[model samples]
Target: MDLYAPFVRHVVAPLHALYEGNPIYSILRELEQTQWLSPEELRRRQWEKLERMVRHAGDRCPFYRERFAAAGLDPARFTLEDFQRLPALTKADIRKETPRLQAEGMQDVRIRQGRTGGSTSVPLEFVVDERSAQRKGACALRHNAWAGWHPGDKVAMVWGATDVDSTFKLRMRNLILDRRFALDTLRLDEAMMHDFARRMRSEQPRVVYGHSHSTYILACFMKKHGYAAPTVKTVVSTSTVLADVERAEIENMFQCKVFDRYGCEEVSLISSECDRHEGMHINLDHLFVEFLQNGRPVGPGECGEIHLTDLTNVAMPFLRYKVEDAGTPTAHVCSCGRGMPMMEKVQGRVADFIVTPDGRVIFGVSILDNFTAKFMGLERVQIIQDVIDHLIVKIVRGEGFDEKVVRGFQDRIPEFFGKEMRYDLEFVDEIPREISGKYRFTISKIPNPFQEAAGRAIGRTPPA
Candidate 1:
């Protein structure tokens, strides 16, 4: 029934590519075939690309040149171990040494400046070249295909992104080629959800995409109010952590598979879940990823901090960049037969980990989802650990919320956080969002275990 999708995918896309002299279409075709390469072959290719990128960065980039020399690493002959010995790039480093991070003699290439969403309250400015942009776009397309979404398919978005440029050309492109139905999540209310649900029921978009929490919230609203959302072919959840309970709720409400994606503005697409839904397949072709603990790579199934080296971005090479995220790497090969490696799971951000009074550290997600969320009459919850022995529990009340819920928390706080921990409940009409329009369910004010171990390397000072 949707004839426009085929026209946009075939004709409009190619014409736009030709008009702009963009190679993304060709690059996408190449990635489509490369996804099937053997795992060993992919790793070999990654190593080759890494070698080339390292040499380029060391020779041309002032920042890497100084860093490599200080580390006593020769780009021409350094082994993988030597490369690992190089210092991890922090957001502070990027902020301070942005100009030096850029490669020299890049006057011919088109480069653009950008900033991160500051979801962690630490925004970063960086640059990306034209080729890197094209490649990242192509990589996204390849992953979208895995979720049953193509370039031209109608996609309803519940994103809180503020980076879009609504120029006339882009508006035309969205209207014709992209066919996007976007819901701005900067300020979501019941009225907005009603309108969104109403439009979705009539439009029947092929794909639904949004921040994980925002999408889940929309689905919850629709279900509670008896709004009939269309059953799209695929739902893509990205930007924030997608908990298992939230995933189940989204799937049940939308009647489709929720493909969770992980990435950042600094690096476009890191990994995405495929049709098989086993785990997220890493984009090995574009990034050299490492899971580190105590300055060394961790074994499979063990949690570690993620370090990324972008092999594709020559203008600004991010070698062993500390992404401030934690994830568990896995050696399990996917049955989908993709040669790309998999990550067992992405643990929440490092800043989201709470430090106990007894010096034990635990992920905030465990406290929020596994324990507090099960409480009855709770519409939303945010747990803030200001100090080791105190917590501020922010709750948005739903129907039937009363003293019983407060009593429930009083009993469970000791059971979960120990007897020494004290808490104050603040009933809120709605929880606030970050500047980037994403909601953080749990926030910790104190330094985590990794911060203490890494010290200033992670740009955070540990308690003396």
Candidate 2:
């Protein structure tokens, strides 16, 4: 037998077993049941949980202990205000503190090491324990519950990853769960897309979940061929930005509700769109979220970078972690009766913002919607803005490609800025995937003088 087989059976399999039956899953179920709680009651319980997590981190995590002390505060006496006083932690901070954050005398404090898909070009490495991994899975399940799916419901996952080799244990688990996994690491060609649609229709999954881009590509294919996956109850989009236009198109083609989820590898579920679809409801029970602009808290309905603390993950607690995404906070109570504050909109990642020559910022997602609405037979597209006046449109086209689609995209962009802008369309055979096998929608190459002057400047380079 292979030498590694023993390790998988003894270590990995057992860990997986523990993860599937952990208390985190139970906690998630409990939260799902509390979706009917009043706004005030939900707020009270969220704060109580946040305080407990803060105290736990102060007592167990050395990094947080030093942080609390340096701020001239006591963790035991910590309140919501005191928690807000702590400095926000960025990806750079986590990289710098990796060694110190590890537990004493432990060779590998991380039970698992997760790699970000390099959506920002600066792919992150986050460590998670067994409990944290379980929590992440449970949170994902709760999001699926929004679409009326149960634990054993048949589902199909179309996602990209660097590691494509699945072990025997994983295969068995998939079989037991009645789920199918599709690898969309390559561009969606006509033949491949046809095969995918065939499999999807035959399988008749309860829900389909994957990257928003890939899902949209599939939906486009179905729309053109007059095919629909009628049995699929829901199409869940994650891992990348999903525009309203794309969501509507997907729902129309797939004949299901499009539930968009937002989160990172560090924390499992941050916020999810509810049944009412008013906005994303923040998972305040498991996370404490803040919107910060210029290092200060922004009030309700203000847009800023999202800073979050994972109150559940004690092994590698992220205290005020800068998520590098822009969004607006909403104090409006949801019609669904969940008291969690709504995230009115997630304006995509900071890197997705295009800085124009006149110092105007255009949201990349808004531009993507314009193209998706008018363009056809397009597999993937990336927008690169090097300067205010210069823009590059990289298009991976499908069968029967024409310049008319490109012209249509060009025509719609001006409406986004309310001004005519100069851009060049370049058709390519493929848009290269990033190191982690995910495609980024936009990249800015123009160097920011402030970042360059700091001498820690890193250039932005999108894959291909």
- Best candidate, TM-score-wise? 1
Candidate 1 segments exceeding 4 Å error: 120-122, 162-165, 450-464
Task: Write down the TM-score of every candidate.
Answer: 0.94, 0.83
Tens-place lDDT digits, model 1, residues 1-464: 77888888888888989898998889999999999999989999999999999999999999999999999999998799999989999887998999899999999989877676345455678888989978988898889889988877888888764323378876776787778777888877778788889999888898998888788888889888998878698999886778888899999998989998888777788889999999999999899999999899999999988999999999899999988778889988899999999996677642277677876777766775778767878998888888889999899999779899999889988878878888899999998876656666778778765542221111110000
Error of 1 at 65 (Å): 1.2
User: Candidate 1 has what TM-score?
Assistant: 0.94
Clash count per candidate = 0, 1
Report the C-alpha lDDT of model 2 over 1-464, residue by residue, as the tens digit: 22433454345544655675666456666868776687688778877777777777777778878989887668778666777788888777777787555444344444777555343445556676766676666666677778665555556666764122377766786655334557464554678778878887777677787777667767877777877674876777775667777788888887778888777667767888878888898887678888888878898888877888877666677889876676788878778877677987676542255666666665667667654546776767788876667778888887666877867777776665546467888888877765444565777666542221111111111110
Deviation from native of the Cα of residue 344 in model 1, angstroms: 2.2
